[model samples]
Target: MAQVLEFRLPDLGEGLTEAEIVRWLVEVGDVVAVDQPVVEVETAKAMVDVPCPYAGVVTARFGEEGSELPVGSPLITVAVGAPASDPDSDAGTEGSGNVLVGYGTTEAPARRRRVRREQQVPVPVNGRSAAPEVVEGPVPVISPLVRRLARENGLDLRELTGSGPDGLILRADVEYALRAAASPGRPAPALTPETTVASPATASPTPAGTRVPLKGVRGAVADKLSRSRSEIPDATCWVDADATELMRARAAMNGAGGPKISLLALLARICTAALARFPELNSTVDTAAREIVRLDAVHLGFAAQTERGLVVPVVKDAHARDAESLSAEFARLTEAARTGTLTPAELTGGTFTLNNYGVFGVDGSTPIINHPEAAMLGVGRIIPKPWVHEGELAVRQVVQLSLTFDHRVCDGGTAGGFLRYVADCVEQPAVLLRTL
Candidate 1:
C-alpha cells in the first residue's frame, strides 16, 4: 500500500509567513519527481516556485489559485510507493532532501498528521456556550495578518463567515466586522462576492469607488511607508546641480568602453563615495538601544517600479564595486524586478536607497526615507536648462539632488554637507576621483 505524505508550504525565508497561490504546476494524480516545482506562489517580496519534496503520485491538492495559505498549510498530498504507468520509475517512499526553510523530508511524514489530529478538539467560541461548541479544526483562516487584525480588534474569528474560498477568512472579513461594530446604530452590511471593507473614515460615505485590499506587495509598501512616517523624524535637503561634466564624462567613457556605463551606476558610485565621507548617513537608528548603528559596508538599494508594485533591490557590498559592476548588477536586478523574480534577500538589507525618480519625468520629489535606514538620495531628471556656467548664462544639463535623512542620526549640517558633496560630484565629475 502507498503511504500518503502531505507537503505543507515551506517557509520561503526572510520572515515571510504566507503566500498566495499564483498557479499550479501539477495536477492531482500526476507523477511528480522529487524537487519538481509544483506551484508558483506570490509572497509580499516576490513570486516563488515551491517544489515538492516527495517523489510520488499526487493524491490531493489544497487551496485554489488566488487564495492565500500560511507557511505550514498543506499544499499537496502524495502517495509514495504508488504504482505508476511506468512501473520502473516508481519512487518507492523516498523523498528529496532539498526543501526551503521550516521543512525537511527526512523526518517521518506522520508528525504533521499527528499534530492535525491532536488539534481537532472541541472548544467554546469566545468562551461562550459549550452547548454549540466549535471544533477547533483548521479554522477557515490562512493569513496570520488576518488573524492578528481580528484579535487586536477583539473580534472572534468563528463568528464572522469568510467571503473567501471554502469560507476562508480574509483581511476584508475582519475589517468589515470591525466597521459594523463601530457603528452600532447602522445595520450591518450583507457580505457578498463584491463586498469589501473600507477604512473607518470612509466606511459611512458609501462612495462608488472600488476598494482594493492592501495585500501582497501593495500592503507591504503601505505598512513600510506608514511605519517610516510614524517612527522617523526625517528632514529633506535638495540642491540643483549642473551635470554637464558628469554627462560628458559618461559619454566619453562609453565612447571608448567595451561595456556601456549607466547614469544610475555613476550616481551610485558617487553615493558610495559620499557615504565614505559621511558615514553617519549610512547607518540605522536602533530605537530600543537608543543608539545609531553605523554600517561598515554600503548595501545600496535602488527603487524600481514594476507592474506588481514598487520594489527596492539591494546591491550587496556596493562600496566595493566599481561603476561597471554596479551598472551590470542594476541591470540584472531591474530585469528581475520587472519579471517578478527578485528574491527576498535581494529586496532587503538596504543601508541606503538611491531613488532615481527622474525616470518618471519628474523634476523633484521629497522622498520618504526607507525605514530603519538613515537616508535616501533622490535624483531628479537631467534636462537642459539655461544656467550660469563659468560666470556666464548658458544652456547646460542640470539635475536636482534631494537627500532625506533621519534627524536622529544627524543634524542639518551633516545632511546639507552630504547633499553638497553629491552635487559637487555631479557638477565636477573629477571630484569623485579623490575618493576613487
Candidate 2:
C-alpha cells in the first residue's frame, strides 16, 4: 500500500503570511522528483517557485492559479512507495529531506491523506457540456467580490463560462459580463417586460478608462507606502550640487575600466560614507520602546521601477563594498528586479534607501521612507547649467539631492548634515577619496 504524504506550503520566511498561486508546474498523476519545483507563487516581496520534499506520484493539488493560500496550507498530495501507473516511471520511494528557501526542517507530525474520486459532470440531453445559446449550469465562483457584482447586476451567473482555472469565475469575468450587458444594441439578462430597469442606452456607462485591480506587487506597494506615511513623522531636506567632477571621474574610471561604474553606484558609495559620519540618519525608531535604534551595518536599498511596480532591492553590507563591488551588486539586483527573480531576502532588511528618480526626468521628490527604515536619499537629473566654478562663471553638470528622514530618529540638523556631506561628495569626487 502506498502512503500518501501531504505537502503544505512551507513558511517562506520574512513574516510572509500568504502567497498567490501564479502557475502550476505539475498535474495530477504526474511523477515528481524530490526538490523539484511544483508551483510558482507570488508573495508580497518576490516571486518564488515552491519545491516539493518528496519524490512520488502527484495525487491532488489544492487551489487554482490566482488563488491566495495562507502559509502552511496544503499544497499537494504525493503517493509515496507506490508503483507508477507507467512501467517506465521513475519516482523514487525516499524523500529528499529538502525544504523551502529560508526555512529549516523540524518535527512535523506524520500526516494521513485521503483521496477521493472527482465528481463527474453530467452531459445535457443534447450530449454537450453546455447549451447552445448560453452556458447554463452551476457557476464556479469563489471570490465574494465576483458574487456581489453578479448579484448587483441582476445577471444570471449561470449564463457565463468562467475563464479562470477549472472554469472558475473571476472578477474579470463578472466585469466583462457587465460590460457586455451594458453594451448598446445588446440584450440584458434577467430583464422581463414586467421589470422596470434602466435601458442599455440609459444605464450608467462603464468608465472608458481601464480598471486594473490594485493587487500583487502594486497592492503591496500601496500598503507599505500608506503605512509609512501614517506611522513615520518624516521631513525632507534638499541641496543643489555640481556633479561635473563626479561625472568626469566616472568617465575616467570607465575609460580605463575593467567594469563600468554606474552613476547610481557612485551615489550609493557616497550615501554609505555619509551614513558613517552621521550614523543617526541610518537608524529606525523603536516606537514601543520610545527609543531610536541605530543600525551597525549599511544594508542599502535602491529604488528600481519595473513593469510589476516600484521595488527597492537592498545591497547587503554596502558600507564594506567599494565602488566596483557596489556596481556589481547593483547590476545583479537590478537584473533580478527586471526579470522578477529576486528572493524575499534580497528585497528586505534595508537600513536605508536611495531613490534615483532622475531616470524619470524629474527634478526632485520628497520620497517616502521605506517602512522601519530611518531615511531615503533621492537624486535628481544631472543637467548642464551655468555655475560659478573656480570663482568664474562656467557651465557644469548640476543635480538636486533630497534626503527624507524619520523625524523621530533625528532632527533637521542631522538630516541636513548628511545631505550636505553627500552633496560635497557629489560636487567634488576628491571628498570621497579622503573618506576612502
Candidate 3:
C-alpha cells in the first residue's frame, strides 16, 4: 500500500522564524527524490533552497508561490512504502521526509495559501528556445523564479547557463545579467573611498538629498539594530594598541599562497586565541533561558559592510586554524558577503565578532556587539606616530582597538583582560607564532 507523507519547512538558520517562497522547484504531479530542490525561500539574509525530505510523486504543494510560510508548516507530500526509514539518508530509495528533529518537522497543514504557478520555458541544448524543458524523473531543474527573472530581463537562459549543481539556473545568473545591462556604456564601478557615493557611475553626481525608503536587507538591519540598541543594555571599552609589528609581519608574509592576509584576519586570530585563555568571553547570554551559554569553539564573525547593509558571517572554529588559514577564510567569507553568496551556515554560529573601521582612517569607533555574543572587537587604521622606545622618543605605527561587551554577562575586569590579551598579540606578532 502507498502512503502519503507530508514535508514541512525546516529552520533555514538559527532564530529564523519564517521565509517567503520565492519559487517552487517542483509542482503537483511532478516526481521528486529525497533531498532534491523542492522550493526556494528568501529570508532576510539570503535565498535558500529548501530540499525535498521524501521521495515520491508530488501530491500537493502546501503554500503558494511567492507566499511567506512559517517554519514547520507542511511544504509538500511524498509517497513512501517499502522504503528506507531515513528520508534524508542517501539510500537507493527515497524514504520518508528527512526533516531533522528539534530544528523543526512538518506536521499537518495549518492553513493553505492560494497557489499560483508560473510558466517555465526551457531552452534547448542547441542554443535555442524551442519548448520548456519538461522535467522528468527526480532531477530538480531551474526554479520558477529564475525562469521568471530570465523572461523579465530578456536574458536567454541558453546564452548563460547555471552555475548551480546539475545545471540549474540560479538567482546569481539573473543578477549578473541585470548588472551587465545596467553597466552598459558606463565604466565598471569600482569601490570608492567615500561611502557617500556608491557606484559613482550609476547615480548622478548631484546629491538627490532625498530620503530613501527602507526595504529588504537595509530595512531589516535597521529594524534589528534599533531593537538591539534600545532594548539591550550594552557596554563598551576602548584600548590603544601598538600594531607596528603586525603590519610588518603581514607585509613580509604576502609572498605566500594564501589570500593577502588582511588586518581583520590578524585581529580575529588574536581574539580566537585569547578566547581559549578566557572562555567566558566566548559565550552568549540566552535571555529566554536566563543563562549565559558558554560555547567551546571560537566561531568568529566578520562584520562586513555591504551596499545592502552590515552582515556578519561566522567563520566556524577559528581557533583550530592557523593565521594563513584564518586569512583565507576571512577573505572567502567577506567576498561571499559582498557578492551575496553566503550560505546559511556561513551566516550563523558566531561566538565572537570583529569589525574593522581602521580601513576608513577612523582612529576608533564604538561598534555594537553583533549580539548574544558577549563581545565584539573593532580595529582602527594603523598610523605612524611618536612613542617611547628604550626611554627615547620614536615613531611607531599605532592602532586603536575598541571592544564592546554585554555588561549584563561580564564585568569590567573580564572585558579589560580580553582587550589587553588582544593588545599583547597585536603588539608582539611573535607571540602568536609561539601559541600556534
Highest-scoring model, lDDT: 1
Task: Return the TM-score for candidate 2, rounded to 2 decimals.
Answer: 0.76
TM-score of 3: 0.64
Candidate 2 residue lDDT tens string, 1-436: 7889999998888778888786676779878776777787888788778878887888999998667899999999999877875555546547767786523233332221222222233436766565334333335664433554676467666666677898787777777777777875775553221223343665678444324556667778888999999999999999999999999999999999599999999999999999999999888888898899889999999998875678999999999999999999999999988877889989999999999999999989998889989899999999998999999999999999999989888889999999999999998889998889
Query: What's the TM-score of every candidate structure?
Result: 0.77, 0.76, 0.64
Candidate 1 segments exceeding 4 Å error = 88-90, 101-205
lDDT tens digits, residue span 1-436, model 3:
6688878887765667777776676767655555666786766676667666665666788876556798889888776552444444232345544654212234432111223343243576777667665443322335444554555456655555457886666777667766677587763433211223243567667654324435445656677677668655778888887788888888887865556777677787888888887788888877887888889888888878865467888889898987778888988887877766677678777888888887777998877767667788888888998888669998999888888888877788988898898899988988877677
lDDT of 2 at 285: 88
Better of 1 and 2 by lDDT: 1
* Per-prediction backbone clash count: 0, 0, 4
User: All predictions: root-mean-square deviation over Cα?
Assistant: 12.9, 9.6, 9.1
In angstroms, how far off is 26's CA in candidate 1?
A: 0.8
- The 0-to-1 C-alpha lDDT of every candidate, in the order given, reads 0.83, 0.81, 0.70
The superposed Cα distance between candidate 3 and the true structure at residue 213, in angstroms, equals 8.9
Candidate 1 lDDT trough over 10 residues, lowest sum:
110-119
